[model samples]
Target: MASHLFVSSTRSFSCLSLILKPSPPLLGVKTLFSRSTRFPRTYKPLVRHGSNAHPKLLSALSSAPPVVAWKSSELSSARDDVVILGIETSCDDTAAAVVRGNGEILSQMVSSQADLLSRYGGVAPKMAEEAHSLVIDEVVQRALDNANLSGNDLSAVAVTIGPGLSLCLRVGVQKARKLAGRFNLPIVNVHHMEAHALVARLIERDLQFPFLALLISGGHNLLILAHELGHYLQLGTTIDDAIGEAYDKTARWLGLDMGKGGGPALEELALEGDANSINFSIPMRQHKDCNFSYAGLKTQVRVVMESKNISIENNPISSANSEDRRLRADIAASFQRVAVLHLEERCQRAIDWAIKIEPSIKHMVVSGGVASNKHVRARLRHVVETNDLQLICPPPSLCTDNGVMIAWTGIEHFLSGRFDPPPPADEPDDAMFELRPRWPLGEEYPKGKSEARSVKRARVHPSLTSMIQGSFQQQL
Candidate 1:
């Protein structure tokens, strides 16, 4: 039984009610204060589907030979009342929520800057930062109220901490730190894309790691190896525009509404369009690396739109004619195909890479907005069948951004003891608050990235392993 309650300040967040054995559940929270903490990372952090927290979490923490004040289960309610305060200012939306450690959502409030950015077609970074600055406090407060909880009621604070616009990340982290300081709660830094992959596990923790994860989101195209909590091996990444970016640019070229760019709109348009209308060649099918390229497809859409005399430079995308609409749909179908093809090819490469590293992977899972695309989803299914890989994705809605994913990620981390002391803020490396327009997934090398390829080849994880794999291979 979860309900929404507000603080006297009109703040809203969720309250969780779970049925636990009448045992004293400890509050197991870990904190990471710096980046160079050389702890041998383990398990892929994600919730078990329908099971509030992972059963293996407690066991993993017990395995952690560290000293933390209390285990979450030890300090938690008899019903295992675990609360996560999550903030998502990754992009243009300023969102905050209080969710149960389980899959239940208590209160979620998203203050969208759609109207503000609609005139510009896409989000402007400074504009996004300003919007977050104005509303994050109110949003966070409301999430707390909705959960019928206060800062003191929270077990941990989770914020989207990486691979996002730096300016925006700072605003969110700065505010969250203040709150954590006030409450003296452990703060967890979450990877934005990883949260997308783990949201499905919150509802289906059975989707074990050592599987493949094709993460396609706006600004990110990654092939991750999920071995266990705090562990992911990024097989390869986008050499250019991320798949969702291609969709967004294509959608904009076809004059889709602002804030409703490529990802979601592409899904809708593909449904009404023909799959075979315009057969576009799949990108990088011959490429050996697990990387992808979507810039070409995005440019193709632009040229096709201009060649067909479709003008999208105007407002109100409804301005197009029927002929333009057909062109848009066919183009959408074709573009979706290329994107999926790129993803499938890369996913196969990751599988092969994993095979070389660890050969006992149970299957692969994908959970992100791109995974929500029927075409992408279908392509993943085909790969699963052909390669004998397990294809998993969150339900359509969960594939995109949501507070539930954050709460779920928090639960996973809390259980694994992959956290540090609840500091005043999530980032002890406060200097890292600067936005990184480019941050490679999982691994970070020096200017020697090119030279590291040969080394990476040698470090590939075994593909078919019964045991868990780590997040990234650094030896190569």
Candidate 2:
């Protein structure tokens, strides 16, 4: 996922035999010259097995160049068609899906760790890994079954490699590697966040390259310019906590149900309170840069809850006291308002900055978990409309982590010939491969351009703004 380019110059080889020639003893040790019969004729000697060779030198030589071998039939079939099986264990879910080259999702399956949420209150990495391990095989099998296909029918296998919990990511990566090796399928490593941003293309075929993307999820808050399938230019990132983190924390403090996750729970509760009942300032209003900060806003909400003596024990809104319920809803509503405003501000700035870099940019694709919020979507719709750009967001289900997105991203990369050979059958189960847990989506902000040029904030139609502000008033 971290490296998009696939160079096939190096391939794994099956060793048939080794011949060793003994040499005169040196330093009370006999030296040996070794050669493998399977070595390519073009192979040149780089290191020899001698008594003087250091252990580290031998370790380095262990990773010799792979011998390339491909049957004519296999090569021909490979070029005919591609259907990818994508696995995603990048977070709290175990998911697998089958997707064809033409952006059709043949089958999809997901096993979420919602059970752990009630017990642990949040994602427990080790526990989440165990959950993934328990259900991954079944999930994959179900996906294949739903598609009426099997491993043999798949052209390649893909899995999220990083920018997620390392423990959880390993479950998906290892499972995918095993399937690829067993089925002799090429592997496409997928970046979790990149998959989120690109999945929109599948939904909106007219969406083109050089569009702007605002990726907001539990772990990420980013505004990137998608120049191409594997290229991006980051314009802004969260300076502190991600927007979803703020939402989750606020939800927990507000005593919202943990079953549906903090963001969704808060969104539901916010609908019950007047958005204008409590005022929460938008973050980074003074800073014209596109960067975001939600920690301050989160702290502000905590302070307000403490001052108002808001009880977070066992869903305050459902308690016997009516006024207590109203207070909780008010906090949820106020928090949602400011959280979405920050997104609007940064998205507006990102749109202006991206237009300068690529004038043809006419669409803003919003993805990731937070993008599923109706209020957030409404506000962003207004932002893009004011700027003469269309806003594209995947459906609510696709906005969350799922195998469909990974599979689609894999299809995109597979078409571009970005893939790696299947792991050898005899490869150890614990063999090390490139798995980045903290990979960046693309290049960071360009040097000397840390701050985007100031752009006037897009003006929302007063009617629309008033409607949102007054949304919860009627409920009260």
Query: Which candidate has the highest lDDT of all?
Result: 2
- The global C-alpha lDDT for each of the candidates, from Candidate 1 onward, is 0.62, 0.72
Q: lDDT by residue for model 2 over 338-416, one digit each (tens)?
A: 8898899888888888888899998999999999999999999999999999999999878988888999888776544
Per-model TM-score, in order, reads 0.74, 0.77
Q: Give the per-residue Cα lDDT of candidate 1 at 269.
A: 75
Give the worst 10-residue stretch by lDDT in candidate 2. Answer: 1-10
User: How much is 134 displaced in model 1, in angstroms?
Assistant: 2.4
* Minimal lDDT window, size 10, model 1: 17-26
Candidate with top TM-score is: 2
Error of 1 at 247 (Å): 0.7
